[model samples]
Target: MPLALLALAISAFGIGTTEFVIMGLLPDVAADLHTSVLTAGNLVSAYAIGVVVGAPLLAVVGVRMSRKHLLIVVMGVFVAGNLLSALAPDFGWLVAGRVIAGLPHGAFFGAGSVVAASLAREGREGRAVATVLLGLTFANIVGVPAATLLGQDVGWRATFLVVTGIGVVAVSALAALVPYEPARPQQSLGRELRAFRDRRVLLVLATAVFGFAGVFATYAYLASIATHVMGLEESSVVWVLALCGVGMTIGVAAAGPLTDRAALPTAYAGLGGLAAVLIAFAFTAHITWVAMVMVVLLGAVGFLMTAPLQTMVIRFASDAPTLAAASNHSAFNLANAGGVWLGGVAIASGWGWTSCALVGACLAIVGLVIALTAGQTAARRATA
Candidate 1:
């Protein structure tokens, strides 16, 4: 991997930390801002809205800018947003700051993937993209936990300040390491929009929305399940989450090389494995030891498909990969929101805590079916 990938990963790390650390600090934030914790929870939704709206919007806006320059600008935006959040006077200001910070989330990864692929030695593009995403997986393991602890000990404001510092370092790294690549003359809003017209690109995006949703369905409620279903103490919830992060890192590391060999096949295996793991998790939740193992498998199988899905969208939309690539993150964010809602619905319906896993399994199966249909259609098109 190029040193430039290190820059992209650093940017990803800062973004990931700021995004998730808020979850742990909601109580503190609510206390400080004189608001309810439930209201503070809206901060998370605010950031997601920014990501979904900004990903493609920024990609299109920066279509003519140099990739290197665009990356730096977005990271700069990230730094500013974190700084604003640190100094925010009230909850509303904090919410706006989070949205500002999130504006660059999808855009950075979108352009960063393209830049990483361009810099890689031939045939290693999948690995390069995965390397960039490693920062995000590692963030779950290290960044979010550390930041959450920091927020608890010092103050929630301090956490954002530290993240701002990380953003600054990332901006400097990107400026120093990434090579200059001028915008292609053929690249335009029209060309990028056309990429969405391709059936393969749409299918791949749909696959991401549904496939990754399965992972989030269980993940969003894992703490509740750990306590209610698995009979674990509150303190043990962190360990379960950490173990899931470990599983995510392992899965992403393995996905790179597998995707390089065959993107669609890798996706097929990942989605199939995800459905199996979720079904197994539904049955195993009552067994504490087995439930922990299932958590690891759930994270692993759920993330295994990410690299291949990202690679497929980029390749299928080769003419305007940036927008397509960025849209992939937006799709995942949609999955996040949708899965959380569906999981909540299942629980609210009087089903047990483990019922979410069954819902997740059904979602994974749906994703697998879509992926298979996309593959068969592509094959038919090629044969024609």
Candidate 2:
């Protein structure tokens, strides 16, 4: 693997930490800010909103820059967002900070995947993208839990500050290590948008949107699930998250090899596993051991879907690999927002937390169906 992939992973570490650390700190943030727990949850929603709105826009804005310089600039934005979050005086300012921090979330990985593939041998693109995603998977296992603890002990503000430091390190590493490829030949904001005109490109993007919704639906309610379902203390959320992360690391590492062998089949199998795990999780939630096991499996199944999905999108958008890959992140983040909103609706309507699992299962099945359609489309195209 290229060392530049490490830089991408490191950037992913910071981004993932900032994105998820808030989940563990919701109670503290609520108490400190003198707001309701549900209100503090809006911070998570706000960040998702940012990712949904910013991913494609930022990708387009940064489309013309060298991938290396663009990454550094994105990290700088990420650092500033975290710094402002650390110093936020009120909830509104914190929301603003999170939105600012999240703006680069999707674009960075989208563009970074392209850069990673560019640096790899031709047929190893899936593995290359998986290498970049490793940082995100690792963050769940280590960074998020550690950062959550840091916030609990020191202060929530300190967690953001620590993430700010990580972002700065990523900025420096990217500048020093990643290769500076010249801007894409004839690539422009308009040309990038043109990639969406392809039907297969649209299908793949939709696959990403619906496929990842299952994970987000469950994840949005994870802390509550820990307490209400598993009978765990709030503090145990960190450990459970770590268990989930462990699953994620294994899943992500395995995805590259699996996709390299059979991309669509690998994706469908992973989603099927994820759907089954989530449904089983609802019933297992009351058992500590079972819940722990299920969380790990959920993480594994969810992450295994990522690299192959990216690979599928890149292959589908052969003419505009960069834009399509970047847009895949945009679509996934859109799933994050949509899934969470739908999950919220279920909870708010008195369906209770277990409803999240049911909702997630349904979403996964939807994704699986779409993947089947995409597969058929690919087969027909190949024959034609």
Highest TM-score among the candidates is held by which one?
1
Taking all chains together, each candidate's TM-score versus the true structure is 0.97, 0.96
Q: Scored by CA lDDT, what does every candidate get?
A: 0.90, 0.87
lDDT of 2: 0.87
Quote the positional error of residue 23 for candidate 2 in Å. 0.8
The residue-level lDDT of candidate 2 at 203 comes to 81
Q: Summarize candidate 2's per-residue lDDT along 1-384 as a digit string, tens digits.
A: 677998999999999889888988989999999999889988987888778777777777787888788888878889989999999999999999999998888778878888887788977888998999989889988899899889989999999999999998999899989988888678787777787787777887888888789989998788789999789997687888888889988998999888888989989998899899999998888898998999999999998999999888777766566667777887888888888888878888898887888898899999999888888888898999
Off by over 4 Å in 2: none
Residue 279 in candidate 1 has what lDDT? Answer: 94
Question: How far in Å is the alpha carbon of 232 misplaced in model 2?
Answer: 1.9
Q: Per-residue error at 150 for model 1, in Å?
A: 1.0
